[model samples]
Target: MKRSTCDICHFSIKTCVCSYVVSPKLNNKTRIIVLQHPSEVSVTKNTVRLLTLQLTSVEVYVGEKPSDFTVAQQIAKTHHCGLLYPDQNAIAVESMVSNSQTIDTLFVLDGTWKKANKIAMLNPWLNHLKKITFSALPENKYAIRKAEQSYSLSTLEACAYFLECYEKLSAEPLHHLLTGMIHEQTKFMPEDVKKRYFHEDD
Candidate 1:
């Protein structure tokens, strides 16, 4: 049977994280545009929903094709757009900020590396934007989920960090919310299984 889910956070009611949802949305000038793969929309561990809920300037489009992103494309054309993808010529976020390069809109791909690569390949126009990347990433805090890369961060964490550095805001609220959600999720896990997947120190 399908579990009843919360209309807000979208988690199963028993595991709903609405309590951790930020009350006043975090304000920022850089508009976040998340190009989410359709497969990620229903995944329990995906963080894009939380990101959208807490940030005032966020747009999420769920699809893998160019046609699905026409609005995003238009926005990109009109704004000082930058893609949060680490390409060979990508500029570090700090460097861009230091140099006073304005990024009115940031495009973030929400998917695994393979899936993100596919999105990049399908949308050739994305390559035309200035690529932005992080130089030093903090430790991953989403302990309930596993990432293929050591440097990988959940969508929420990435956005939070980007906004922290770019907008000079604290990411603590989002980080705290994520920690609470992880704690809530671990409550239902079998002791042995939970031990294998998560550690207190992490």
Candidate 2:
């Protein structure tokens, strides 16, 4: 039987996160563009959906190749855009913030490390954009999902961090919502599993 899903958040009725989703009041003009992997569309753990719901200037495009992102490319060409990927030559986001350099749009790739790298490789045009990365990341709070790197953050977390630095605003609300979602998802897990991932004994 198909589970009844929330038309908004798309999570199953029992796991709907609509209540925790709030549109954060951003004071900056930076727009967000997410290039999501097709395989992640239906995954409950994916955080791009939360971003679309919370940010007014966010767009999400689903694809893996250059052909699939023509519209996004056009938009990027017309704006001071940057790709948020941690590459050797990527500039730290803090450097841009400190220098008062602002981008009109920011492109974020949504997928696992390998899958995101695949998307970047398939879309060679991404190489032409200014690449930005965080110099230091906060501890990962996404306990329900396992990432290849210990410092990996959920898409929502990374975006919040970027916005915090770029806009110089508090990301507490976004972090709060993320914590709620993680709590909701982990509530159904076995105690041992929760302990292993979240280090919660109770």
* Best model number under lDDT: 1
- Model 1's alpha-carbon lDDT is 0.86
- Return the clash pairs for model 2, or none: none
Q: Best TM-score goes to which candidate?
A: 1
lDDT of 1 by residue, 142-167 (tens): 87788879899899899898988888
Residue 69 C-alpha lDDT in model 2: 99
What is the model-wide C-alpha lDDT for candidate 2?
Answer: 0.84
Model 2, 111-181: lDDT tens digits are 99889999999998999898999998877878778998877899999999998887776777678777777
Root-mean-square deviation (CA) per prediction: 1.5, 2.0
- Clash number for model 2? 0
Q: Mark the regions of model 2 whose C-alpha exceeds 4 Å error after superposition.
A: 23-28, 98-101
Worst 10 residues of 1 by lDDT: 93-102
lDDT at 133, model 1: 92
